[model samples]
Target chain A: MSEPVVDTTHEEGETRLSTGGLGRTLLVAAGVVFWGWLLLRWANDWLGGLFVPVGQPFVAPATIESLGASIPGLAGAFDALAFAVEYLPALSEGLWLTLVLTVLGIFFGFFIAVPLSVARVYGNLSKYVSLLYTELLRGTPLLAQLFVLYFGLNISGYVPGFLDGVFANNAAWAALVGFILNSAAYQSEYIRSALQSVDTGQLTAGRAIGLSKVDAIRYVVLPQGLRFAIPGWTNELIYLIKYSSLAAFITVPELFKRANDIASSNFRYTAMFTITAVLYLALVITASRMMNYVEDRTAIPGLGTGSGR
Target chain B: MSDNEHTYLLEVDRVSQSYGTEKVLRDISFEMDRGDVTVLVGPSGSGKSTMLRCVNRLTEIDSGNIYLDGERITGPDVDVNELRKEVGMVFQDFNLFAHLTARQNIMLGPRRVLGLDKEEAGKRADEHLEMVGLTPQADSYPGELSGGQQQRVGIARALAMEPKLMLFDEPTSALDPELIGEVLEVMRDLADRGMTMLVVTHEMSFAREVASEMLFLDGGKIVERGPPEQLFDRPEEDRTASFLRRITEMHS
Candidate 1:
């Protein structure tokens, strides 16, 4: 009976205890965390300041009537947001300015990036120049750069009226100045590394066919270099959106500034700021999708598919 | 054929090259006649590739004159691009533009350097692609093809310019064992058609079978130069004999 009871059904192998168990656990854990966060947000809104001992210093959040009433800081935010919304055209006009700034910044940054990349790679000039240029831009903060343009020109009385009038008045122009410098510094490295990745033999091959230095760059080297750089360049595009928020400080009304202005004008601080958060979410999500589309379009299939860099 | 007897197609007189402080080629001198497949055979670091690069002025020779068809290819005054068009090159890696198809790869040189119209370039590309037996693969990118096919595309790309000479720096060196024969066969076909070629390769069989004159380069200098039979089967110098012996022993 013992001999006949011997089992040979151990063929499923070890480590086959079901990986879905771990996945399901992780899924439940994530669901719990997400709902916990949503619950906290909901409880905070429905009941005033969730941690009040009574209706003493902080507003009582447990009462639904108190939740509808505007609290002090939020009351001002609500009023500011309401005022901001009634005049939609003014805020939308700022989009034109933002667009102008983005375009000009990209254009000028391209000019700066191309030459700097080439210089860093092949220029007979000292390492000091490249070092100096990179350090000078990166060492100084962008906000400081905007201030320097504004105040340096103002204090010295050295600026032409037309120049000051255009840049100082237009938040867009000042933003462009700051954005271009920032973009140029970073782009130089991205593009330089890309150019360097191209085999030295490509230059030799071009030379073997008799391409001039300019022609080699224009034809052989630049195309390959730029192809490798596309993904990094897409990253730079996304970064431009977030970093662009700083331009609002100089007075160019991009999405963030408009959102802030809306929240401040409305007494419904929670609702308005939530809408602002959603607007930012939408912008970033769209940018991410667009970048992915571009990457798929431009990348070399096998190499790019793996997301190596 | 005496070395001094004929007018040379390209001549390197006392040419030397070095990177930074280390010298690669020291006092190297050689000459090639028109329509000759002059094979340079040696172990790695012989600087044969560097020597070939100097002819096209692909690499600048530190101190010497490289006369290509009697014109100094190394000078600043001579249009370097013009020199390149006259002398095409095939790399070991077969550096075809990956974004482009085989036909596009071949056509690029003629279209860009020669200023040939798209039609003329296309015609020449087809002719060269046919010559390399890659007409069927003309529309395919370099990435899609096998190593052997890529090399054929490289050969076709080089030939498309209709250059006076083609420099092949280890064309078959990077190929898989099975793929080497197809590339060598293409080289042999090119030799049969009488292309003036300077081939830096280790394929002794290709050299023995196809070369008109074979130069045994060791340590950046030509140790011996003669017909393949004279060099391979009945070698003269100690180094050449030893090199040939090593090759034969390895094969066996």
Candidate 2:
């Protein structure tokens, strides 16, 4: 009854440490804090130079004046946000265009990558076709793809007209084509890695149990592989935020292009760039949180308590 | 039942497997009978698993014919999902779907492949779990079970297929020493109840206790084959004799 485990059901050999166990833990934590403090002390030298008081301190501190008290900067950011809100109808319209472009681009990109990833995995075509597609996509720069679509394809007489005037001109569609193919190049790699990470033994087991190769892939292999790819897929999703900025080059007028237009008109360069940084940061943060939620939900069962193999 | 003995249940004639220039199995041939337990014993990379995988067409044989129930194998033309409905397999790693409960893992094939109604699949899963002595663990995930219990779930999952033939690849080799006996007991019970089985294993006691015929494979070829007593007690080939002695010597 006086054994280490108070509960009879608990395993006897396991022992619990005293509360003071964290004293050494605190010591290690203090060492880390000390190191971080040293690094920050060095960084403050340069950071201090960039930020200086230009107006009255909010609290009128006795020891030192507030350096980050740039009321104009705050007011400018708020004005930028408010200006965006004032242009809500236009920005909302721009928002819709951005969403439409992203959704369409990803959908077409997914379609394109499925065949490409499959070809890469199964070597569906002759060596010439598979190797050609893989090397072409992997070697070419995405910006070059945009340039090719906007300028080269136009000259080469490859114009198609479905989305030619939907976003006010063919430039949007041209951007769509570039973004889709560029994203597909990256996504094909994502899907291929996902598929490869799945155990060959699982496929063999599924087939041995009488599943056809396609059925086995659909039922067993895909489920397992997709689980592993979720984090990587989310990485690609967040990358689309930064990647969407590239659309401005082809005159798609996504967030960055909108901000750029506003910045040029207002002549407040630093303020506009700061506002852009904040918005992009918000987008990436929200996307990351949603992705982490999904990852947490789909985590392997035995792993929740951290004892997973 | 009477016709089971009269015709070979499975026949592999002049089977060959290759990848480009490298041949894996060279014109391998064998026949399996109904209501018989055949043990295929081999060292690693002996093409024993490849032969087992080919029976289910998991590995494509370059040139060969397989006969199941006296019908031509015709690997490409056959409906594999339908074929798998009648032929079950167990793996050394157990390969129990970690996400599903033991009951769900067993029922997955019956639902997806056999087209059994959910209710009927559930009933069958329960019965098969009972068969494998895993009734109490029906709701547990595979990860929650011990290795022997997980292997039993693998057996249950296979049994749910209601297959005519069962193939087991190194089922007990991955299990802990204390756990192997439980899995082998399940296999022995399966054999006693007249399940046609082709097992590849390293457990000598299991082979001796359950097999009606034994094959000793070496270097991708069948080096020796006989009844367990003949193979274990009086092996003709020096390799077979040496292998058996080595296995027994390790056990001692």
Candidate 3:
């Protein structure tokens, strides 16, 4: 029995060691790639005009040809590498647009969600209205919503003068509006559940201490509910970041759109799409880490975490 | 209006309440003078807690009036929030706001309802924390404190409102056997300080020790009520005597 136990332990140790080594290698590779991208971006800013004309793409055809000549039968790899380097700047610009859309969508969605959730939980007649709004947004596809705002509204001539600039031609703004509405509906569900999970006695206690109904909710219920909703809220934000890719269908020049445009033109789908995926992965990991830090900082001692009492 | 209406700090005159067909309180009448500690004692479902809730307008009475300081509080026109400010309540479960520290919980009423500045509210919270012997645990969250300590904080939170009368609804019922004494001790101290209180409780000894008048309620009516010794020792209604015997036996 002891010998079998020892054998099992040794086998587990070997498995762990191999996995750990693989993880370390991946981490080092990721670090090298990240720093190299930053350095390349910096060099491009300073020496880009000398290397490639301002109006043209930086293809580096001579370097690709020299590498292909030196390493026979690896011409495809060299071509893909040169294509990636040429379009990295465009992808970075697209990444910035994606960040802006996700941040604005989630931030504005939070404001709309709080009131909708409160109405859903507490309002008498307004509850039905809030329910209808959430159901309508959540039931439909975000892409269809974008098309309605971008194409349907323009064709119908229903776009207001101020919003004509946004709906008539601005696909990015239309996509952003769709994202905010969709995100608010989903986020309200998360917040409503959080609000409901708080004990009814909390409101009673609030009232017992001379707080009005609205004050009770504003002070006691919302504070606890919002804290509880943080994890779900963060989940919505992550979803928004990935689904921002759908904006590509509406001609938004976001990360995935840029990747699609470059890939279609150059027929380097594999390289272009893979780089876009990596950039998205980086954004998502950074967002979740920042949210995790927020969750840790705001956690109460005796609540959720079970740290006290 | 009666000539002696102003004599009592709280008056529930023939208040009746029902949830659907089941009547929870039926024509329950009671009065408490300033500085009086009146204890409502009864078996489960006897409407002791409901009676206390009616006094604070937490549960509105179906047919009758409740007056605080001789002003009728049971009407549509009455400002319930302002009434609640004067009527502080402590619950059986010690419902301290879970997210806030004990001090902050006490300060919320003063700062929000009374519109006191933060420094004034903080000072008031400290005084009440010390009053409840919870100054050391002032900064701790409700989850960090034991049940007794939480209930103490609950008492302090209510007292910070400087209410004219405090209602305690089975305040010690949810506490463990050992933890009940500390909460009762705080109640006993409040009575000594001449704070008017209406309490619904099953703790017979505390009721006997602190209650100025003991009201034995049954079937949503006060069957017998007088000084604690009269109800506890002297002859009264058979139901009241029997109920007292059972409660004393259980406690002993």
Which model is ahead, 1 or 2, in terms of TM-score? 1
DockQ of each: 0.25, 0.34, 0.33
Instruction: Choose the strongest candidate by TM-score.
Output: 3
lDDT of each candidate versus the true structure: 0.71, 0.71, 0.84
Segments in model 2 whose C-alpha atoms lie over 4 Å from true places: A1-100, A126-138, A147-173, A302-309, B1-5, B13-30, B60-65, B74-82, B98-101, B139-141, B219-223, B236-238
lDDT tens digits, residue span A171-263, model 1: 465567778988788777778888898877776666667667767676777777877776587567666666777777766677567766766
C-alpha TM-scores of all predictions: 0.78, 0.75, 0.88
Model 1 segments beyond 4 Å from truth?
A: A1-100, A126-131, A154-169, A267-270, A301-309, B1-6
What is candidate 1's lDDT per residue for B46-89, written digit by digit as tens? 88888888888767888987887766778789887777788889
Q: State which candidate, 1 or 3, has the greater lDDT.
A: 3
Which residue segments of model 3 deviate by more than 4 Å?
A1-83, A155-169, A305-309, B4-6
Best by lDDT: 3
What is the Cα-based TM-score of model 1? Answer: 0.78
State the weakest 10-residue window (summed lDDT) of model 3 chain A: A1-10
The total number of steric clashes, by the backbone 3 Å criterion, in model 2 comes to 1
lDDT of 3 by residue, B81-121 (tens): 99999999999998899999989999999999999999999
